[model samples]
Target: MTLLPEFITENGEHIRLMLVDYFPRLVTAIVILIVGIYAIRVIKRIVQKIMVQRQFEPTLSKFLADIMIWALRILLFVVFISKLGVETSAFVAILGAGGLAIGLSLQGSMSNFAGGMLIIVFKPFRVGDTIEAQGVIGTVSEIQIFVTKLTTGNNQTIFIPNGALSNNTIINYSMAGTRRADLLFAVAYDADLKRTKEIIQSVLTSNNKVLKNPEPAVVVNDLTDNSVRLAIRPWATNADYGTMVSEVLESIKLELMQAGIETQPFVKESSKK
Candidate 1:
């Protein structure tokens, strides 16, 4: 590139020189754009590789990979524009002002994004983990930037916002090796406690899915009105919860009734309000 000096005619002999010419400036701008895009792509790949090595959650890994790439790209884009003779000071000032306004307006959304990021980073639950969160009980299918997906036992898909999950308590059932099924079925107070225990033991043994290693326990947990509240606490795998809940209910109801033991009323109504 060469610089040429030109004089303004009919004016007071003032001379001006343009350095580096126009073509070289254009080339420099183009190179900056290329390098910025390439750098972001390379950084994204590196992040993805690191995440894979760390065994991060699959859903989260992809999200992080994409976010990293986009963030770098946006920064590079701003730099590229600045290099291309754009007045970045004023542009950046305007962007900052607009960003603050948007942040205030979408405060809740930002919170959810932060929550989702926490979930991804800390990983309280993962795919296939049965968890109770935001008052919904289901298996986590996927965890994303904005929401966590759940598949209910009935095969219903539920999308829960990330903000609500972080704020509320989350019951992760799969964290422990074994879970106790604290089933409370009250028998009439007059019924023989010994006979009821025997009947429950038999029912538990009959179910093949019940684990024998932990040893199931049948004991009187509480004494309710008109009944003896017996809790059938059994240890089972997370996968066994659904089957246990259903099988225990059916088997206990039938076996207890056959043994002439009456079940207690869940909600007994009185004449008065």
Candidate 2:
């Protein structure tokens, strides 16, 4: 019965020593973690602000900011673990091995990530630009870390992998600011070619959307057995191109009809048989 009190006292002393030795380390690690997290947030906000002031692409800015935050978080974790007396070299080696394994498993994804970095840096096309790539024509809606999203004219959304996008030919329609619309109208073979050309030219010039600098052109494109194909070329800003084409086509049809010019549809030699 005398030994029981001594045993309890020894155990209590051991626990007190353990707490005295480890509690401060624990508290210090937690404080460091809290402060580090707050610092990371502040740094991220500052980086974002700097990028914005420098006119960086929003997608690129956000991506870079996230990468910086994650890297800092990883560094802070290493510090935190080291403070708890855990060996960092082994942990870092394990992390490296795991990263290598993940990288090997996601070769395609890594390629896409590289391509995305290339895009963010080179900036061949920006968000809201109309581009034709990989047999898809649409306005770029978003540029993500792995893919670029497009909104088509028909209101369809497409996700294109960045790896293929960077490697492929990209026709950026919006970059030129102005687009030449090639419109073809067929009229009867016996129609007054001069009057038809004049009518088409008049229709193009009357539209406010058309650029006067380039000057609209109406040329005889081809002569079919049944009709003469008139090619009308008009330069308009990208935003106005679609509307101008539709309006000019309708106007030309009306003007030709009023002038007693008969419009004809082109018939292929095989179809004529």
User: Candidate 2's residue-wise lDDT over 1-273, tens digit each?
Assistant: 889888878798887898999999999999999999999999999999998887667876887898899999999999999998888999899999999999999999989988888887788998999999999899999999899999999899999999999999988998888988877788997898998888888888899998998888888789887789877888889899888877887888899899999998642221000
lDDT of each: 0.78, 0.87
The reply for model 2, stretches above 4 Å from the true place, is: 1-35, 54-60, 83-85, 266-273
Model 1 lDDT on a 0 to 1 scale: 0.78
Kindly give the stretch of ten consecutive residues in candidate 2 with the minimal lDDT sum.
264-273
The true-versus-predicted C-alpha distance at residue 266 of model 1, in Å, is 5.8
Could you tell me the lDDT of residue 150 within candidate 2? 96
> How far in Å is the alpha carbon of 78 misplaced in model 1?
4.0
Instruction: Give the per-residue Cα lDDT of candidate 2 at 109.
Output: 94
TM-score against native, each model: 0.76, 0.81
